[model samples]
Target chain A: MPSSCDEKIPRIEHHQNNSDVSITICGYWSLNSRERLRLLRRWESLVLQWKDVLRFEIKCDESLVWDSSLVVFLRNANRDLSVNGGQVVFLDLPAGLNKLLNLADEGQKRNKEQKQDPPSDGFLSMEALLKPLDFLGALVISFLNLVRGRSVMRWRDFFASARNCSASALPIVTLISFLTGVTMAFVGSVQLEKFNATIYVADLVSLAMVREMGALMVAIIMAGRTGAAFAAELGNMNLNEEIDSLETFGICSVSFLVLPRTLALFVMTPLLTIYADIVGILGGLLVGTLVMGFSALHYLEQTQSALTDMWEVYSGVSKSLFFGLIIGFVGCYKGVFSGRDSASLGKSVTSAVVISVTLIIIADAFFETAFSLLELR
Target chain B: MNVSGRDDIVIRVESLDLAYGNHLVLKNISFEVRRGDCLVVMGGSGCGKSTLLKSMVGLLAPLRGKIIIDRDELWLNGDKKRKETLKKLGVLFQNGALWSSMTVFENVAMPLEIFTDLGVKEVENLVDYKLALVGLAGAGNFYPSELSGGMRKRAGLARAMAMDPEILFLDEPSAGLDPITSKRLDDLINELKESLGISFVVVTHELASIFDIADDSIFLDSESKEILAHGNPKDLLKENTLTKVRSFLERKTVNNS
Candidate 1:
């Protein structure tokens, strides 16, 4: 199909001597895409007519400038010929081309051997489904060891994780908390002003920040930031066999790696939530004074009066503790059990963030429902 | 200095000095690897043998020196020319750093796909041939985690050979293999060298592998931070020129026996 140019077109001459046949490939075999497609089509048709040929001999033109494309085409042709009880023989071929043909033949033979024994199918069985329960049991034992001061938890790693989870996360936490408080105040003031009840906007912002949004927003951010970091760090260690090395030294990897990370998160998340609550209140104070035209002192007084019962703030801070545990445990579990490869490590990090955020939301819902029921009682 | 007439001189490293930060690793090192020659770089555990190999393969730049491959100065060339020169060379890293994400077939096909305009079917056939060369023909579909350590090395070797490079660099090919597997790998290297006329730069501490495959060798001393000796392994053993080299080789021999 290629237009004949300066490059020579390959020609096949067939000669029959008794029951033997010889096919001579003449001219340049430097076939590109178009030429190769045409050549294969022609060869396929020619192979059907040469059924009587018992032995096939191939001879190439000496001045041929060919690539691997030629070799592959010939190999495919030979495969078709061999299936029909004909054997192809190379005559006067260059040493490199001959070696390539031999290598292809060897590969074909090995492929046949592999076909006899199929590879294992990577599927989770019933036993694999229950493996998480075993992981959980080991985690509980590690926690008990920590309680008794017998765990192999590294103080350095724990403090490093704590600093990363708390101080390093301050910027994003402050931004999200301030923005959430401002938006809530603005929306509530608009609705309240219609009823000449704009002064109650402070009460609305205080209740929302202390009871729900502050803790929930902080938890979601930590799940994305800290949870993904935990998964990636542990996944890298798992890929490098560092976990195995620790186990080889008689150290429990769960205690040494997971406990420190989880404890750091558990201790830090509530502190971060409380910080976010203060920042959120300040943001609401700004919106109340500047936008809603309320006095700063009046807004603060209204907020204090609405939060007379400390149960609202306590419930929100308590929810953060549970959210922190869920994020840390899920992240470490995904990381420690990650597959021993880079791709699986990436997948583990992704799943860790997703699962932690989802679990945090579910926990938040349960707490919100429980607190409302308690208020009614 | 007139290496132009000597077509056999494939690689020439002149007055090479390598450093990581201010700590010098190898100093004033010079070596030449000829065509069809297997140059084994030998040293103790912390010696700069692997670092020197990395410099030669363009993974690291020497602190001060020139590396000429086929008369083209590797470091002096621009990006395009450097890539052109690198296309003629293949490297197998320590621990067989195959992409764990891809299957073995895709790993071998990667170089061909990037460098050549060959179609998919042609690439598949070439990958098959390369895998077969390294005795991994049946492992095309298997991921790196699915294969044993030796198989991973072989798969890495197949990927390195996908381009049919003129110079092949292997770092610790026999590091994590059984005796029979190591021997088989050695045999494959020898066969490829003889059949394809490829010059090999192998970095290793295995005496058995060195004796079996090295046509020439250089010994780097950790204390001196320089090449202690250079010659054929057998001749170096017989000459006993450097006490450190002799002791290292003798210690390995004793361990083997």
Candidate 2:
């Protein structure tokens, strides 16, 4: 038996029932007879004879088939015939066997010509053909299942994933946080020196790191690192039909695959935020000591004196947990919903990272707003 | 075709109709598989043949109809009952549909873990026994990605046998293989059927396997969306009124014309 792919050749399949008729001209090249027949049957169901005027074309081999529609060839009587009841049209070969063979050869030559340099003006690969909304919908379903379970309480997978997420992300996060802190201290010192308020630079660094920057920076890093990984893994699984296999085996896809990853992210985010805060504050200290002419001891004293509440560190940690959950959910969801091909998996990974980072920022803003409303400052 | 008294008849599908969106794929389809009988649901492509097998295993919900499996009814009901019904069925998909991530042991052991309360040792012993039954005694540690197509199918069969279900559903079992390999698979299927006494509902258009293993068969007509015929393959071919069936059995091989 030929494989379904082997039997496919470009052709027009037609099916008509009652008033509505449909004709679909498609390249089923490489699909077997069974597949072609199936396509015809599927098209028949789609075009439920709503209008008597319905007509479609199915391209097959060297000629085309038109169903239930009259054909007027531009030249030659060697044309396709439309089937009765708008069912199908078989492109009949010319009467003479020799002429038919010659015509088929010509058609083959033309097909080969078309293939060697396909009209590449515009063609979307199968990956780009998928709708964003469909991908998003798949992602949402995947993400929801990730966050809903008893495994949410486990800190093992969280820490394991966090080590991968945070440890791998540390160099970049450290560099950016350090630069931000240095830039802020340098700018703050220059502006405040005229009034002899350079000491307030300590207050600036502490407030930013503890209240907003620490959790936010850590989440951005995770969105790029762990979130993207989740998408790629899930996308690959989706393409390979691992998720489908799970369903067939009576395994709950959410509980088995998504929960562990989600739980890992949920626990690891806070620790990452803490690491980010320490690095960021040290960046401010280095700038204050070497660049701004403030001693390290003086910087520490001012930072302590400026802080009045414990909520500053606590709040950052709290925000990290929320952002972590969001990242986990979005990452897992994108992966779960990704299209079932390598290209789709790549697209899924890209979209997962983009969506996760965007959400993290949006969530950070919301936290900031809520914290401010409480008058924590 | 006795309608009564056998403690058999594991699956009875009656008046089944199924559709996808605006298209009706199956219309008023009906069939039954006796316990321990091997049934091949054969048809041309897109004739709702695979879909009918899926409906039997409760994989796809029908538009209107009833499917009774081991006395449990499925149709027009909520998803919960339908899922419970599915647990009793073992499916071997067309592509072998094994999880690439897990080893063969894990794949076979999954059903045991989910549906049965058998402990790990018992499950492991059972998994080994099933794999050996399919002639895959030492391949349990290998991932699906590592196995060849025939091996994957055998592994899938091993996994399907894990739960020891009453009904086994296979879609296109001999679809992509050489004649000899396909024959081996058919032989294995026959052996399993005899030893386990489990009912089988297979979907395939493969001619040789159809004749070799199927105790009964059903033909679906794509044009009419109805059950065209059902009975022993030999009798159907001898008495078929449809030119399509005649051509199919004779292997005259229809062209694009």
Candidate 3:
């Protein structure tokens, strides 16, 4: 069947005179026609055999029916044959083919004529290493300007950021924190039950929530939700030249835009951490009451005792403030410096969330060690 | 450097050179925008006409030379002083660049609010007048997203005109607009020039608008990264010393016509 199909393809007949060749093509060459690649291969082999040919003329039949595929093949063939100072000239071709072939030639010429602006280096370029530090310097300047009461920020923008990272973020934080607490209690209860100390599940759940899980979970949540939003919003602003307008007006973009957003996250992260801590403890209390058959008051006593050292709670809350700043900072930095296209803007948003989450974990480790060394743990 | 008593010189660029990273753009561009003169910066695409405008308007720091706006060196001064110098300049960016978040009224009123001690009623009155001046009398309540491209450009011009700066640097004012719409914008620019005596430093390739608004003009060449010609567009057309400048003007007109 493939052999039968090949015989029905367009025919190529050539008449050669010394270094010059004229090839005549006849029949249909639509894009979907089968065995077109075979015909192209045949054409290629013929040109390869006539490597010394100085000029090849292409003559299309009066009844020829072809498409862009033929034009592309001819374009490449023309280029190949012309590589050794030879020329490919189309003879008696249809008007459309002539124009299309000319257009291909003209486009190449045009491309060569114009100086190309190199595409932006992708996400992991060397600039990425120093971007955080550059952003940090700008952030410090903005912070100082804010301290001096010279920052340009809208009160409502801060409220909007707070609302997004806090009020709207509450439901997800609740679900995650509660499930985490329940999971810890279930695991700890099973292990402690073997030794007849299932009551220690309450201590384990409350201690984890107070010392680490609470802040870390909230930071990761905001990183996905709030961090992504900040990146997208500011990236869009950069594309629209809103940032440039502000700068040309002599208004510092970091002071006007970044400060309000980062400050909102800084102020709200700890508050959300506390709320999550309380709800998570309630989740453990439920597990202790139902699964372990302990009174709710007894579970509360255990959690309270476990959290007796206020610094354990303070340790998590303090970390959250830094967590929030990191999220906002990374998002705004990625956005304000985003490239001038939708694809780059999207990449900026994704990287903002990723960087925020990664930085949050690393900073958490740093703070954890610092607290332990200072005897606050 | 010394304009002396020449009130004619509003903007003076002395051998300005600009770059992006290390790629050179404009080189040794020296020109003066006289008071009340509509100076058009005309060139082929990618010729750094807009880059030159950006440098003059305090957006890009030049690699060499100075941009003196009304006798104050723009880049040499403290940022506070640069900002003080900037206040004398209003810019209408390509694509209008209106704060999409703000209504047209608020967009125009913002500069007045931030840079002045005007009362609310005064700001409202001034915004209304500016809007009316651009023929967007009832469009003040609309956001930039709600307006057509031509109206957006008009709103942007209104904002640029809000501060009533000495020089208005417009980067491609007629871009992406229909011929009729662009003509209206050009006419509006002429109206403002006649009424308020504002100096215009417009960067555009629109031949019609160039002829319509430009009292003086400079042409930048991409190959040399320098100004190829400087004069009135009308005068330059008659005696084009270089074929490139002649073709730049003629080809655009031919294509449009």
Report the C-alpha lDDT of model 3 over A120-165, residue by residue, as the tens digit.
Answer: 5656877767777887898898788778876667677788878978
Ranking by DockQ: 3, 2, 1
- lDDT, candidate 1, A229-313, per-residue tens: 8999888867754454333223577887888888899999999999999899988999999987889999999999999988879
Cα displacement (Å) at residue A135, model 3? 3.4
Off by over 4 Å in 3: A1-9, A17-20, A27-32, A52-74, A82-103, A113-131, B1-6, B252-257
The model with the greatest TM-score is 3
DockQ values of all predictions:
0.02, 0.19, 0.42
Docking class for candidate 1:
incorrect
Q: Provide the TM-score for each candidate, comma-separated.
A: 0.58, 0.73, 0.91
Better of 2 and 3 by TM-score: 3
Q: Which ten residues in a row have the lowest lDDT in candidate 1 chain A?
A: A112-121
In candidate 2, position B125 carries an lDDT of: 94
What DockQ number belongs to candidate 1?
Answer: 0.02
Model 2 iRMS: 6.2
Model 2, span A236-256: residue lDDT tens: 777755676566555666656
